[model samples]
Target: MERKRSNRGRWTSVATAVIWIGTTGGASGHEIKVLASQLLTAPGSRDTVYLSWGHIVPVDMPIDAETIKDYRLHTPSGSVNYLSTEGTSLHANVVTVDEEGLYTAEVIRHPSIYTLVIDETGHRHATGSKVEAAKLGGTVDYSARSHQFAKALLISGDAHEGSTKVLGHEFEIVPLDGPESWVAGSDLRVRVLFQGKPAARQDVFARYIGFKPDQAWCFAIPTDNDGIATIRVDRAGTWIIRAQKTLPAALEDRALFDLESYTASVALEVLP
Candidate 1:
């Protein structure tokens, strides 16, 4: 199970909006970012959104081919299916948004991270050999470790007026585009939401992952009472926004000296 309730920061006892991180789990070094041409669309108007998975924090290595197939876009009306993909971009067509809700271009699973662990029940050998468990619960055991994996979920959604919480989990720093979503010479407002609510006073970080005039174009911003942050887009490039937090485990998870840490991010390619 996920870590139990605690008095620690970030990972404190959750209410309706529950955000989580495993006690001893590892995270992916990459993330998926969404791009929409126009966020504020007229009712029944058609628009396009793109999904990019080659967005790794600290570095952006774009892939020359398709990296995902099950990507989608969640709108107020319904979901938009994938139309086509070019290189690392997965294109999805948004038909219309008749209602007054937020439109989100999102993906549930993107960067999958794995690790080896020692646990009860014998595991299979690397060479496809069946190995019997000589011990249980690491009692009088030889070596005990099994492999487990964790996947990261990223969502980049924004509304023209009120930003809705359509898809959000893990430690996500969603960039809320303004009237000029990704246009050059504009300031973008970003929000770091935990679960489905604003994370006030949280430290939000942004950096240019792709090519930029200055390699040191990294900055940190803090969320306000509304859990929203703002950053100015000086030049056009791939902007990466991120945030992280850690907390002590609950009583049950204390056995392994568990420490839960969560990290989340999204990428945006500002047009020149």
Candidate 2:
């Protein structure tokens, strides 16, 4: 049997842990994010991008390839490339850029049900159905239909013409600034959108690549009425920005779950 890597790691550095926790409001779980080794590359460079589930650590746990409902690469010339990884391990997709413009990689996952139940003995269980867990003498603690969307920004050269365009995600975090704004000590602004409109007062979370795995995020802030959140690019490295929105389940879905969750994450590289 292939041994599974333990998802929980120790907080070896107290100072790092304290700083991250203080800014991020403590660590949480179940974050879906896109993963890439390098985002800024030259033309004809091949980049392998993967999807990780259950944590914001860009390369945490690779999800099953079958879970991907859509994978696409949007180009600066307004062309879209449909990508697939049928024969690859864990369905990781690879892209080779031939143009000198900003490229966006988007991945949409199939919706799934996640449920937590607490039994009489006070033990918690993870199940797929809240109704079934309730019948099994377990009190339903939380249940939701989780929908995840992930994106990564890759710049081939200096052409950043389409860096600020919306890609039509159901729930999205669009970077309003271009690669020029990704410098350390600069303010990188992003807007959250839900159903194609501004998502006001949305909570946005971010962290750099070297952040400890035991921490939740390096920074946390909420968007203003215009749905814009300003994140300080404090370091010159890869960063992941994430946001989530949850709503009550539809009438028909109420029996299966209590709510619906939509999560979005964007990964990019920052220069010093």
Candidate 3:
């Protein structure tokens, strides 16, 4: 199939509508996510997928191609297709749908180590090397190796089985039910998985477009022992649900970092 180019003005409008619902898991630092021009579309239509990276909003943050470990599309037919990317300014790619079903756009970022040091003199320094921060004779306020995963859903005609397919991402959020009919005041059932197993007792945060900018999230819920979280769809608009897992570093890695963290997010659209 021939690739399509996304119009800058069209993307600007779609991006403006979903920026309110964008998320980057952690309280500090930038996070990456995938967003589409539209969640619902017709057969033979094209959708522009954006790999957005930023703190809380989906601004035009330029992403280094090397940082993107993987970017692909999972089609309704179960075929995996790699995206031919274009435009680093938005990190955008376009995909076309010829049949009717749901498609998933997924992205994985290379694991990166980050540390924050607060010296005795009350000055803070941020660096990618924890060992370097330790040599400053300062307090390691935060030190963790981060793994990020993101996904966005696009429906061509109707929602289908692809929504529940486990794509084998180290950390992922899977919708238990189809999102084709999600609407305001409804409840969305989702599962958090880590290393192909259910991630039990995890914290999940969610927000919708137009939510309060000062607030971290509009809804906060924890997964049950089965890794299930029932998020109440508060209002109509684009919505994103994110989850994070943090663990103490292994004995060998302790010398380099204090903790390892995994974060995952999924974007959905809810009708009024």
Candidate 4:
């Protein structure tokens, strides 16, 4: 009975070792990869920067074992220092700098790949991270136009995306030429209203419609002191504009104003 029990125990030990080696070996051998969107320059004033990326961990991948330990951001002059890994994405708080130059972030996965370098610049540079590009550039444009007017209001100026507000209305601009009658490069005015009342201090955006729908020309313009916002339609066409009022911690959708509100397509008619 002792001999039988001993043999059984030996077989169990051997099987356990085999399973451990097979499972651990493959997982330990897995390589670490990095990806990013386009590199960006921090706005001249802001210090905090946001970086986002995606990573794939294969099934059976070790949680704490094969994961990245930290990330380092390097500037043209010197290293900005290392940052700890936050789940899969790497984030860093950049020190404000007055000068411009190249910057790179290197991700370190222990005992595996030397380091995956993500290169970007304070001015402009190349980036190989697809995950980062989509996160940073995945913003929608909100702009529109009103129907034809003998004399339309002119709205102009610039605002950062998602930051500027036009009274209760929020909008993004897309470039489209009206009928052949409308002149290009000339300022065409459109009326903006909210609930039949002239909305004041509204945020307006001007985005140039590029050759493709995916490309946009956008700038934010705040409404005049009187709550009216005017935008120039460089190219004339039907444009979809959005209006909204934002409250603390919430966004109010005010797209549909009163019936008397300006019509959607603000035709840029040629002056007879």
Candidate 5:
């Protein structure tokens, strides 16, 4: 049997826990975010990105491991298949860029159910479900998650090459246009797209990670009819933006919480 790597070794970082969108995203329907080594990275450099179920939020215990059915590095020409291994916590894949275009990373975790129960009585549960009536029972029924994340990396000396491309993902967020690099006082414009069109009136969030890895500043804005949400970056650092659509649960489970969520995000850096 293959020795499954511990969740801590999943992403190659100890500080891999993250919680996006304040209290709104309560570990329900999720968005797969790509945390790049650095948003403003040089071309041909070793860039490793992690596919996290939630944002860069601190999560206790080990995150439930879900097999990444489709992990691809997308470009205008086509996509390159990524060999993702199992037993790894967060599916962190590394990519090398030679041509400067729109590099979009797509991560898909097929439907799964994650349940956490306090097992103080030394009862080991094999499944991701609550055992009997354990105190503090939490469940996350994750439907098929299709998350598309894009980062514009124009090398230090090169012109834009590839055209803006979309892989026809369901829940997606595309950086329309803005300054090449964001500063302290800058506004970011992102289109909330669902199935190739704009998603109107949805809540979007941007979590800015400052110099201190332990702290972050969060901002929330709503998308307009055009499916665009503009938010100001008050500080300079790394920003992981996420937005989603929600609906009532198809089948209610009395033991679990209510509702389903679908999310998309931009995992990159904002210059100071």
Candidate 6:
């Protein structure tokens, strides 16, 4: 009887150890909470965003080695498909703001509980909620600064109206002859292409880069009766522009300018 009781006690201890390991296991299958240091600022800002989390545990009952799950970040701006392998805990790098406002980071598994980061000066608010049109009224002009600028393009778009303001700077929407919507950023260039050919002497709109949430930098320029204009982008990065071709009123169809379609855009990177 004594030997049997000792054997039972040994088995009970082993079972308890297994339960403890399964319930509070490694990083996998555990939920993680994160917090950011200061709201995300402008682009090229230092990636000092800090992340910290709680403990790890199993997903369900009868926890085993396979119960361990991974962690990830879903940012509003760039891709968050990649796992967050940074920091001591499962934390991700803070996102950069091409435009100001609120940004969010959600867990891959738990979508409900997420972190919100705001960049504006006053109260915290959401980003991309307000749809402001592009600034600068119709018939924008781009004159040659020193010499006849080559490789320039024209772009335009409808404004969300007062919805666009960066660092307290207000943008005005303008009407143009062509496409609506343009890319944003300084390192990018804009050009007009027709039938796989380049158009010259076009006037394009202009705006600051990384100032808006959309990261779209472009404006509208009115074309002469000949449908010619000159526009150029001195900066680099993605850009969008709009152009419209109106039909007769009887047609009951106003030509729509898809920003994705017919905009001069380029990804530019400048080196010192």
The best candidate by lDDT is 3
* TM-score, per-candidate, Cα-based: 0.48, 0.84, 0.83, 0.24, 0.66, 0.21
Residue range 52-84, candidate 6, lDDT tens digits? 222211011221212123333333333433334
lDDT for model 3 comes to 0.76
Model 3: per-residue Cα lDDT at residue 79: 89
Question: What is the C-alpha lDDT profile of model 1 across 1-272, one tens digit per residue?
Answer: 11221122122212101221222112322345555555444555566655544334332455333444344555555555444456553444444445544554554443222222344554221211113222222222111121111111112243343333435465566666533366555667877767778888876656665523322224555689998887655556656665655455455644332334455565555667
Instruction: Name model 6 segments beyond 4 Å from true.
Output: 1-31, 48-50, 55-83, 86-95, 108-272
True-structure RMSD for candidate 3: 9.3
Candidate 2 residue-wise lDDT at 132: 74
Ranking by TM-score: 2, 3, 5, 1, 4, 6
TM-score of 4: 0.24
How accurate locally, in lDDT, is each candidate? 0.46, 0.74, 0.76, 0.31, 0.52, 0.27
lDDT of 3 at 196: 88
Higher-ranked by TM-score: 2 or 4: 2
Which tens-of-lDDT digit does each residue in 61-166 have in candidate 3?
A: 7787878888888888888889755545566777788778878889998998888677767645465768877776777876788899999877778665524677
* Model 2: pairs clashing at backbone N, Cα or C within 3 Å: none
Which ranges of candidate 4 are over 4 A from the true structure? 1-182, 208-217, 236-238, 248-272
lDDT of 2 by residue, 71-91 (tens): 888887779988775642445
> What is the lDDT for 45 in model 4?
31
lDDT of 3 at 94: 76
Instruction: Flag the better candidate by TM-score, 1 or 5.
Output: 5
